[model samples]
Target: MYRAIRIHGYGGPEVLQLETLPTPVPGRGEILIRQEAIGVNYIDIYFRTGLYKVPALPAILGMEGAGIVLAVGADVTDFEPGDRVAYPTSLGGYGECRTIAADRIVPLPPDIPFDVAAGGMQRGLTARMLLREVYAVRPGETILVHAAAGGVGLLMCQWARHLGVRTIGVVSSEEKGELARRNGASDILIGYDNLAARVRKLTDGAMVPVVYDSVGKDTFVASLDCLAPRGLMVSYGNSSGEVAGISVRMLATRGSLYLTRPGLTTYIAQRGALLGGARDVFDLIAQGVLRVHIGQRFALADAGAAQTALETRATTGSTILLP
Candidate 1:
């Protein structure tokens, strides 16, 4: 038997329960992984609070993990026993062991540690999708990133800097501002008040061509104001709360702004996109251009506490759970 965090209903962190279950066996096109680390993301919290619904009750509550494959099922030829692999989009990752579809797995680089792989796969890919595909950020372009010290924000800043893009990072506090600057933010704005004014001033009143906003509701209006005419507003998350009551006129009044709510699954829906995106993320990390910080780690059984820390915004960078 192996242990996993199971949630029978939706609510707060208190709803997460650790339980033992029989080890799963790999079926056709599947592989059984001995999980080493699991990533904690806001999406997990969304699913936990019923903001995002699951398929059924008593479901495992995680989407990413790194592990060693112990067995491969029939027709699974790319992986074998003892292969080190990581997956960013697999469900049921908060467990000691899991059986996942082979197509979803990516082989981990030999030098990349399990913790880094688990912590970065999802977030790194997210940054890649946003910067590379979403707007195709150009060299010397200026952009605004909300929650700039958070996992995806930090990666986006560093990656954008590497590509010669200037980043104006919006952080919640001076400490987070410092963190953002260290990670490649060209300018930092603390707090949300007068956000557009600050961003405009930083960009010499021209405003930015894109605003990557993860803090929904509270920062939505200000994010729109920070954009240039016909700019893109990538609203990817809702750490503050859901963005609502948006009308077509809002976009027209905001200079023909374009808005998108892209998901990791949609960005990497195809096999080629999945492998290619993951490869780019891993390659950037291997080259040291992208530094992934494993800020906090908790034992698998303490996932509830981990979730609490994440929800309270008490942790920075990436948080992981060890099995």
Candidate 2:
């Protein structure tokens, strides 16, 4: 038997309940993992709150984890018992043990700690998709990032800096701004009040070429205004709230801007792409080019409190559950 956090309804963190479940058996092409660490992300909150629908009422909610394989089902060839692995795009990670399709997971590098892998897998993969595929940020280009001290935000800052790109980060406080600076943000803005004007001053009235906004409804308009003519607005997350009632004319009026909502699943749907992206992220970690902070650790049964902390913005960097 293993413990799992399941939600029977869409609501707040209290909906997440800890219960004992039978250790699952792996079916065809599946591997049963004894999870060591699970990632806690905002998407889990989205599902719990019904902003993002769950497939069923009673369901598991986590999407990323690192673990050791205990069994491989029929027809599985690439992995075996005792293999170290991690997955960034799979669900049902809020458990002590879970079964997943073999192709959805990647080998965990020997040097990467299980907690580090769990902490950064999803966020790092999302950052790779954003900085390399979505906008393909060029060196010497200055871009704007929202929630600069956040899990994904800090990774993007460090990764973009490594690529020679300058980041103008928007954070909520001076402390967060300092953290972002240490992670490679060139400049920082404390809040969104008069955001465009402040960005203009920072850029000498030139504005930026891209704005990577995860703050959603609270800052999309201000982020749009921070872009240069023909700049791209990457609205990837909804931290404050979901953005709604957007008029297409808003794009036209805002310098003919380009907007995209990309997710990690879409970028890594292909087996080759999945492995390649994971390899890149792991390689960077191995080379010390990227550092993921495990800012908060919660026991598996304390999943509700963990989600609450993440939703309230009371935690920074990557939060994880020790299973």
Q: Scored by CA lDDT, what does every candidate get?
A: 0.93, 0.94
Off by over 4 Å in 2: none
For candidate 1, the 10 contiguous residues with the lowest summed lDDT are 195-204
TM-scores for candidates 1 onward, in order: 0.99, 0.99
Counting only residues 3 or more apart in sequence or on different chains, how many pairs clash (N, Cα, C under 3 Å) in candidate 1? 0
**Residue pairs with backbone overlap in model 2:** none
Q: For residues 261-287, what per-residue lDDT tens digits would candidate 1 score against the true structure?
A: 999899898989999998999999999
Question: Which regions of candidate 1 are displaced past 4 Å?
Answer: none
Model 2 Cα displacement at 154 (Å)?
A: 0.5
lDDT of 2 by residue, 1-323 (tens): 99999999988788889999899999999999999999999998888899888878799999999999999999999999999999997879999999999999999989999999999999999999999999899999999999889999999999999999999999998988999999999999998999999999999999999999999999999999999999999999999999999998999998999999988899999999999999999999999999997889999999989988887888879999998
lDDT of 2: 0.94
Candidate 2 least-lDDT 10 residues: 307-316
Task: Give the count of colliding residue pairs in each prediction.
Answer: 0, 0
Question: With candidate 1 superimposed using the best TM-score fit, by how many Å does residue 12's alpha carbon deviate from the native?
Answer: 0.8
